[model samples]
Target: MMNIVQMGLGPIGQQLTRYLAEREGISIVGGIDPDPNKIGNDLGEHAGLQKIGVEIAPDLDSVALLDKADVAVITTLSSLKKVSPQIIEAAGHGLDIVSTCEELSHPWQTQPEVAKRIDEHCRKQAVSCLGTGVNPGFLMDYLPSVLTSVCQKIDKVKVERIQDAEPRRKPFRDKIGIGLTEAEFKAKRDSIRHVGVEESVRMIADAMNWQLSDVEETLELVKADRDLKNDRIDVDKGQVSGVKQVGRGYRDGKEVITLVFKAAAGVTHSHDTINISGTPTFTSTIDGGINGDIATSAITVNAICSVREAGAGLKTMLDIQVPAYFDEASP
Candidate 1:
């Protein structure tokens, strides 16, 4: 059986625990979270499952059976800098790691030194570490790269993901600046926008061996046409109801990769569209789009075994085989 330690018990983490519980051959050995409310609670119960034996501890050090785990699934924070220490600590305890931190998806372009440190440390600890999620991990970067494999030549690539925020969870609503005024949204653009567009651009460029001259990421607020209210938040007419963030990768002043992310309170017919320009160009679209939360949790759990079997080092989705849903039992 593959023993696992879960770090971060937030919405996504909880979803992961519930998914792990349904699978056989995998045991959730322990859980760690600093939240006072969750520190002593049963991990399974907190995840909306019947009480299981594993209780959440305040930290990894508090999980006395840490050594029994073969891997760690982390969904704590989006910033790689803030989460790097936890990664090193987990690796030191001999656990292969799979994290949902966006910035770590592909850090070489912006945080090379820290990425290097992580790679070196993980190598020394003889454990592998990877960062992944739905957007930066799959749809925007890795998936586009994979699609390019069939193309004999490629020129430009465009990807657009549009979703309705009304049906999303509170955290998703909050992250996309759902109910802020136009001025407030403009002032906090840098802090409020999605975190990994540039990283996704970098990953695709690396995959295609493109020498990008410049890469740019920008976010614009989508004002509410009229008053909008959802279970999560309220938006006044003319207030920022959503966001339109675009990331572009330029090769010698020519745009080669374009990624557009749009989410709003009432976007109808949510979908993901990818178009490629090449010797034999094509376009692919998912009718309803992939659910970010569910896909993130599924991919994170699906990747646990891949991380364990991977070579020791800091890795990205590109460094391993594709992850997918599975069914099997263990001893």
Candidate 2:
């Protein structure tokens, strides 16, 4: 079995622990989270499973026998600044890594220096590190890249991921600016908007040899037509219900890739769509969109083996075997 350690205990992290526990090929050896509420708690308790022997530690320095673990599954902050230290520490222990940090999906295009540092460490230690999640890692970026393989001549690629925010966790809902005043939403636009739009656009373009001059992104709050509330938060009528964020990537000043992410409460339709403009143009859609939380956890767990076998450096979905659920205890 692959020994794994969990590196966060937030909403996504807890779900990841649950998924990891369910996978037969993996063993949870430890967990780390700085949250005072989580430290000392049973790992299984946090995951809503029966008690497992592992208890949450406060940091990587505290995870006993951390060097013996095969992988560190990080479901943590989106910012590379905050997550970089964890990456470095894990690499020092010679552990492969799989994470849900949005920026990590394809940081070569955005934060090359930080990416280089992490890459260098993983390479020196002979391990691998990857950042992945539903939107950036797959639907908007990797999936479209795969679709283009069937086209002879490529022109443009567009993807739409429209989601209903009501079903999402409170953390996700807050990340999209739900339950805020118009001013509050706009103020946190740059900070709270989905973290990986530009990265997603650039990953596809770079893979296709479509050099981009620049990438542009815009964010606007979706107003709640009616009152919307879940167990975690509330949104009043005419207040901010969600966020509408769009990202455009241009090559030679021409828009070659466009990604539209619309997530709001009371959304009439929820779907993931990809349209490729080429000689053999095609459109693909998934009704009722992929649930982000569950998919992120599943992909991270499934990708563990892929990361361990990948080149000793930073990787994206483009660089590794396609990650999917597997029942075998060994690969």
On TM-score, the leading prediction is 1
lDDT (0-100) at residue 238 of candidate 1? 87
lDDT of 2 at 307: 85
Q: List the residue pairs that clash in candidate 1.
A: none
Would you give me the overall lDDT of model 2? 0.88
The whole-model lDDT of each prediction reads 0.90, 0.88
How many residue pairs clash in all the candidates, one count each?
Answer: 0, 0
What is the lDDT, from 0 to 100, of the residue 262 in candidate 2?
92
lDDT for each residue of candidate 1 in 1-331, tens digit (9 for 90 to 100): 9899999999998999999998888999999999998988999999999999898999898997897988889999999999999999999999999999999999988799999999999999999999999988999999999999999999999999998878777887888888888778777777787789999999999998898999998888898888887566688898888889999999999999999999898787899999989978999999999998888898888888777778999898999867767685333
Q: Give per-residue lDDT, candidate 1, residue 95.
A: 90
State the lDDT of candidate 2 residue by residue for 21-77, as single tens digits.
887877999999888988999999988989998999998878886766889998888
Model 2 spans with C-alpha error above 4 angstroms: 229-233
**Deviation in Å, model 1, residue 177 alpha carbon:** 0.9
Give each prediction's root-mean-square deviation over alpha carbons.
Answer: 1.2, 1.3
lDDT score of residue 296 within candidate 1: 89
